[model samples]
Target: MVDRRLFDIARWSLMVAVWLLPVLYVFGLMRLLHLENAYHTCTQARFGVPDDRGLPVFGRLDSDVLPPRSVCTWVDGYTLDRVPWFVTPTMFVCLVVAAAASPVVISARRRGVMAGTARRPW
Candidate 1:
């Protein structure tokens, strides 16, 4: 059998990890968008008219002048291109579900003799 302290620690670790997942997802999405923005602006300045708004994705020219692959820390043309629009919405749903479920889970776990210990604020 698992030690009770180790079990509690593992449980707390999992809870914290699940709670942070949505935050990480949001940061990732923002970074991906920022990379796209950087590459877009870079390409616009490189080949297209300055301050142009009609440029295609990643500021690719309507003609053959495509933006070169970005080497910046956040820029990964291949990965950026594959990031789906559904990711943000999916994360939103997961975050909401986790938030809603936490209280219910805490209440459920508090039904034992340790109820007093679980009375602290979530």
Candidate 2:
């Protein structure tokens, strides 16, 4: 048996979180759309991110050009191996929790066991 109060809290929390899916989806799309264009410059110049290690990178303009992007060009390459602070994980968690908890809550309420009472799923 579980505490009815705790169960209610979890059920409502999951419901609220699941309701944010649309907002999160919109926010994710907005973020992707607002990103600056990297393939071309605003002034009609071809720009590209280069892959350079200990060697010089080349641009599309001239193959003879030893380097394409300067040191300042390749900024913001900090990619840590961790979960992004985006809506992806949050939305996933919400969906999973809601899916798992909805059946339990509904069945409990229907069985006349959840009328302000605690009942464990059997």
Which candidate has the top score in lDDT? 2
lDDT of 2 by residue, 40-121 (tens): 3211221333324443332222111111111112223322211225557777777788887777677667655567554456
lDDT of 1: 0.45
Task: For model 2, state the Cα shift of residue 84 in Å.
Answer: 6.1
Query: Over 4 Å off in model 2, which ranges?
Result: 1-3, 34-84, 113-122
The TM-score leader among the candidates is 2
Model 1 per-residue lDDT tens digits across residues 1-122:
33345445545654765876666565544434433355554454444643546544442312111121222222234223323345556565666656665655554455432233433457
- In candidate 2 the C-alpha lDDT for residue 108 amounts to 60
RMSD of each: 11.1, 11.2
After superposition of all CA atoms, the RMSD between model 1 and the true structure is 11.1
lDDT of 2: 0.47
